[model samples]
Target: MIKLANYTQGQWQEGTGPGTTLYDPVLGTALASVDAGGLDMAACYDWARTQGGTALRALSYAERAALLKQIGQVLQDNRDKYYDISLQNSGTVQNDTAVDVDGAIYTLSYYAKLGGKLPAHVHLEGESQGLARDNAFASQHIEVPARGVALLINAFNFPSWGLWEKAAPALLSGVPIVVKPASATAWLTHEMVKDVIEANILPAGALSIVCGRPEGLLDALNALDMVSFTGSADTAASLRGHRRIQHDGVRFNAETDSVNSALLGPDDSDAAADLLVREVVRELTIKSGQKCTAIRRIFVPESRYEAIAGAIAAKLKTITVGDPRKPEVRMGSLVSRQQHEAILAGIAQLSHHCEILFNGSTEITIQAEAGSACVAPMLFGAKDPDTNPLVHQVEVFGPVATLMPYRDTEHAFELVRRGMGSLVASVYSEDPQFMAQAAIRLAESHGRVHLVNTEVAKVQTGHGNAMPQSNHGGPGRAGGGEELGGLRALKFYHRTAAIQASPDILNRLIQNAE
Candidate 1:
């Protein structure tokens, strides 16, 4: 079996004894195994803070950013390898895998280009302040990288993109990071990290990947350490209660479960309904609807409910489910058998609250192993969203979405907000007033309010796409943290301070070689 090892302290360190074996989601065949046993967590951290940290701190922001550019090139050159790994490990087709692989490269490149314009080690928050009437002393508020390391705990879906989105900002801001990828789909992440390490594009201990179990990972963190996690809310809650997080004040950022939504506006045009149908189908089929930002609840005007619901169901019918290796297949299996079972149970429970609009056939389009976890997209409708709390409360986390009829714009807003907090809420319509009102109202509960009109429908990034320029996290049940708002993400890995000094000293602190 192929064994994946952890990279830290400037070497590839393999774990001890037998490890957990990973399986092919399509054929149920053993692919590889990974272990996280008998490793020195404390030593791994010290290497990062002392060796990698010092190396990065010595460079200017522009200099550090150039390293990101080099890292992006390494991934770009090895893109096909990642795609093959995604098909075997993630059960994703070429199009689905591109989102994770290409998206990661794009994020890294963006930060690299953006960093070329930033100052060296210091970021002045505001203008200098006068401390004495004699002008002998002054103060300047500035921001700089924190001295401790950053720990990234990623989710099973989008393993490649998840690693880069968090790592890019942390590295650009001059902080070293250690990544712990979700065990089920870690091969793609491991390969990408391995390539960067072998290329020697980064300093020693600058980036590390710890595969398999994450026991004692949190305990190794100090108060100055930072953590960015992407996973379930239950796990987020449990991690928050860790003594280091609760008492020692380790900075924690989480992007957890979100029942994202899409609303068709007051306009009842066939064009509008068709646009809504196309986008919803794409969201469900893309990544097999495993995205945290995927639209789970869909709202439409009561008058156009029948027309819109029928259109969406018809589109979902065209989705081809089978092994991604088949050129004809448009959708593939879930990431693993355990996830497949969880989604099946979730579907059964959600069936109680809504009527089936479309129930996809279980028969695979292409011949495959009987145990392949393939599933086609399913659609449902809830007449009374308020009465059915499960439609909003329980996120199925698969190729499933619910349609709910709304009396008017206000009712639509109320039903969508009932989800508590979501990563994004999409408004589709040609009606300007309705779109504007919806964006305003939905902004209360969503991190992003995407307004899609006929003019924008052609060019708007779909509801599920998380752009690097826009912030990606949400409030409340979505974990109330932030990530990937251009260079704004740098703030999370940095510390702000006000330096009180003389005028000459304050001016000299602004840039390198000042």
Candidate 2:
């Protein structure tokens, strides 16, 4: 089998030590072996700072943006190759793979176009403010590149989109990047990076990939460096407490998993009921419910609990679980055997507090061979979710969700808050007042909330989809950071400084002297 290589110091080097084998989730066939034992940690950082940082910082925003546009075109022209690889490694159908491949291309192009409109200099000057009573002294905030490398630790669920989304802003801000993709799905990311490097679209060291264990990378960071992570909360906590991070004052941004929820209001119209059922099922089955923004908890009015549950259960029964390569399959296997077993354990724990409304099954019939890691969709309903701590706190991280009944609008708000904080939430209501009130209440705990009604339901983007134009992170358990909110994401890689001086001095410093 081929071994995955690490791209560091502008070269591809094979790993040392015994490596772990990666398998195809749909075929149970070995794909590659990954290890990072032979790589030099300090040299990698030094190369990025000296070689990569110098090349990127020398270019103006417009010049860098043009480079990004060329890269985007190259990736778009070869998207089919990425889709084929994703189907084998990720166990996703064409549609699911498009979410990663197409999403990445769009983000790169968006940043390319936006960067041209910005100022040529690396620093951006805010509106000047007069400080003295006679308006003699003025101050302004200026944003400039941090002049350090960005370390990106990505999740396995989106190998392509995850890397590009973070890389776009970092490159746009004139900062280089070192990517550490999750080991399981690193092949796709590795392939994409290889394409970019071969095309010579980026500077020699501007972008690099470390496919295996990120053993000593963290120790090499300094105070000026920035780290962005996406994974479990446990991993986030461990990284946040690293001694080097504290000593160097590295900027750390994390986006972790949370039990995101969706609310069904008291509206009993067929429009509301149909929209609610359709959206719930869609979120549960898409990407096998591995999305960080997927709905893990469902809150409904006491009177409509049974009706909503029945409607969702009926819709789920029609879905076919099998290998994504087969055209008839609606849902594919989990990413790997380990993830499949983890989801099974989570279901067992949740079953203690709730009754199984639709236990699709532990066994499944699939078009692929028997070794594939496939599991049926499972749905549990809790009569008194407000009292069940597990229902409110535990996240299955797969095709599973808990349905609970709420007393009223206040009760719904309380249940939603129990999630601590989430990346996204949804409310299905036709009543204008109820929708407005619920949105305000839920906004306190969620980064984004989707309000669906009869007129907008047909065109609405579902709850699990994170757009490039909106902020994707949330507060509390979801990780207190913001990402991809237009130009806001670029600020993470830049530092802001306030400059106070006379009007003439300020004008000269800003390079706008009249």
Give Cα-based local distance difference scores for all models.
0.89, 0.86
lDDT of each residue in 25-117, candidate 2, tens digit only: 989998877788878877898899889989998888888899889889888988999998888888988878888899899999999988888
- Give a tens-digit lDDT track for model 1, residues 40-135: 888889999998888898889999999999999999999999999999999998999999999999999999999889876788887888889987
TM-score of each: 0.97, 0.97
RMSD of each: 1.7, 1.6
**Which stretches of candidate 1 lie above 4 Å from their native place?**
129-139, 362-367, 511-514
**Clashing residue pairs, backbone N/CA/C < 3 A, model 2:** none
Q: Global CA lDDT of candidate 1, please?
A: 0.89
